[model samples]
Target: MSRQLAVMMVLLAASGLAQAVTKCQNGSETLYTSASCPAGYRNVTGSMRSHVMTVPGVAKNQEADRAMSALRMQAAAQNQADEEMDLRAQNAFWNQCLVIDYRVRATERAMQTTEYWSYADRYREHADALRALQYGMGCLG
Candidate 1:
């Protein structure tokens, strides 16, 4: 029992001799040492100790990453919406061009089949106007 007590005492004394570490920072550089910080370096050992020991600047970096991700997602959504709107506008323009082309074809047919030269001339003028509108609207291109 006496030997056991001596061993326990030695163990306790050894545990109590555990070295303390100090963290120091100078500008953007960091260092750890068993002694106090050197000149031009600030002691940051107290701030470095916490329940979880979260590193400094990590939390801020994570927040910035989340903000950047949100902005990228918003920009992608806006681009998709703009592309969809442009497609819809193009579809509408093509539909209108098809209707105008049909009208011009019907007028040409009428001009060819009519016996009255005056009616034929009117039909020709109407077809020419429709063609002009189609070209002006970029449908011919």
Candidate 2:
């Protein structure tokens, strides 16, 4: 068992030093494909360019910017709702209610960061972050 453990440790160390995204296609030097890592580990999409969304049929330079703007709008509106709650507590001088609301919002926000957004029309991560941030802002209120 000791010998096996030593061998496994050696293999694990070797694997840790090598992490390469595979090529998107053979002979395609400019493009690289995303590779799956070990189980229970997720690749941060920001580190890899594989997930960039592009609309092939749309031939406009501002399309991407416009789409992003729309997402921002949605995120802002969604987050703003939570702020109103904070304002209410502040106006009423309800410290207990404010603290309780913030605690609940904080927990929800933490969970939202990793939650799967199925119906969001924009960047799901951005949407989640917005929701979380709004709740966080409420907590601080």
Candidate 3:
């Protein structure tokens, strides 16, 4: 009976020791079942970690930002082109009006020197044409 009791105590002690085992590995894949690694070995199981996983919305938000920037660039280029074209058209019309005014003054001078009233009539016609064009184009109120 004493021998059986001793065997039972040994089995219980072995089982308790087995339960206390904690698996630990080092950088070289060496495993230890103790509280600390021996000399020349470091504990790798506690400090090793993985990076955080990416959320699904982050990629979508980045794509949306890129698209908005591209659209803004396109709109800015278009607006610049429109302003340039508007300036060119305004300069052309201004030059045309200057030429018409010059013609009117020349015809008036000719009428004053030659005693030909027809030149005065031509001046009036040119002035009227300029005024009509300016009004039609919304340049004159």
User: lDDT by residue for model 1 over 1-141, one digit each (tens)?
Assistant: 635643643454355432345678999887765577999999987776332122234446678989999999999999999999999999999999999999999999999999999999999999999999999998997
* Candidate 3 residue pairs in clash (backbone atoms < 3 Å): none
TM-score per prediction, in order, is: 0.61, 0.23, 0.48
By descending lDDT, how would the candidates be arranged?
A: 1, 3, 2
**Where is model 3 more than 4 Å wrong at Cα?**
1-55, 117-141
Tens digit of lDDT per residue, candidate 3, span 7-90?
643464444432222234555565434355666666554543222111233346668989999999999999999999999999
lDDT of 3 at 34: 34
lDDT of 3: 0.59
Error of 1 at 83 (Å): 0.7
Each prediction's number of clashing residue pairs: 0, 1, 0
Of the candidates numbered 1 and 2, which has the greater TM-score value? Answer: 1
Off by over 4 Å in 2: 1-60, 92-141
Worst 10 residues of 3 by lDDT: 48-57
Task: Estimate candidate 2's RMSD in Å.
Answer: 29.3
